[model samples]
Target: MLNRFLLPALAATLLTTACTEPPKTVAALPILGERDVRPRADGGPADTVYAAVPAFRLTDQAGQPVSNQTFAGRAYVTDFFFATCPGICPKMQSELLKVYKKFPTDPRISFLSITIDPDHDSTAVLRDYAQRLGIGDASRWHFASLGDRAKSFELANHLLTGVVPDSLAPGGLAHNGTLALVDDRGYIRGAYDGLNAGQVAALQRDIPVLLAEIDGRKKGVAKK
Candidate 1:
């Protein structure tokens, strides 16, 4: 028969072993889209470059010019919404705010809310919206307008793959309700459903992974 002392000691040893086990490895996030792909000159096979957010110049809520350069060397999350949107826009913003709050003071991350209704969402209008959202840091969170409705839609649909205009849809627009995660190189690394809590939670978890990847790349370049 097993001794009482041996049973207790064995349980303690099992608990200790479980506590000392190595952590499970986490998979890295994936780069998204194929817009940047190109055919090889040799015509052997097409080479695919990771899709990147292209350069753009737009006016911020402060009436300041903001461009892709504004986020150079930084990772950012982006979505499209109009000030007067009555449907998904508010939900999308609320979801995105969770992400913004997650990295409230982290300079390495930024957030962009681009307006699809540029004619209505001027700099002043964007400013008022920012105020309504209680956005305290204009530098970290920008409400911007492309100032051209067609171009805005193009950027939303083609570049960011987020929004689409719908005359019959509520708020005169329909969007994918996605929050795009862009890496430092401007490549899109992930896109999360802005309307779903579970997807947003995944986005929150993935941001740190992308940041760590950026740090790793920097360290590699330094070593070379």
Candidate 2:
């Protein structure tokens, strides 16, 4: 799993190594990922396409289908975790709970927790887990899995939170506590340290900025 700091480093790689610096603004968060330059159909400037998350099919706690379409027109916070995790999972989820409470009923927001130990965290188990966490709304918060360990890990990597098996690790798995924020367009807008309260607070602040950006786009208003 990649450390939280690695996200900023990955974003900074696009910058020149010279003394020059890009102007910083709070109105819009930077999109983080590899990109491609392509010719525009309008024959205008070439478009730079950031890597968007690929579509995936998952089963939620309620045994309902969950995919990118489930979050259409909404922004979501996602993390990788197993129900039996003995290390950072509890604290990470606790921090995420804070963000969830802030927008528990907001139709524009959602949460996703992808389990790497699907064999042990079946839909019934995940349903019990979400109930234990007091997350009663499956529509607002989804505890989902790909139903295969390898497939789950592969999907985690696609979401930028890599997961792997490790005999020495807690619960026989090694993964980071990264809370990834994805906008409605399926582009990653932010990544936070799930174990750090300050970073989580930063995530809380950034969510509204992202939501505002989404609203601006809907109204044909340019984002700052």
Off by over 4 Å in 1: 1-26, 35-47, 159-162
lDDT of each: 0.86, 0.91
Worst 10 residues of 2 by lDDT: 13-22
Estimate, for each residue in 61-115, the C-alpha lDDT of model 2 and write its tens digit. Answer: 9999999999987899999999999988999999999999999998888999999
- After superposition on all CA atoms, how large is the RMSD of candidate 1? 3.5
Error of 1 at 17 (Å): 6.8
Residue pairs of candidate 1 with colliding backbone atoms = none
Per-structure clash totals for the candidates? 0, 0
Instruction: Report model 2's TM-score to 2 decimal places.
Output: 0.84
Return the lDDT, model 2, position 10.
69
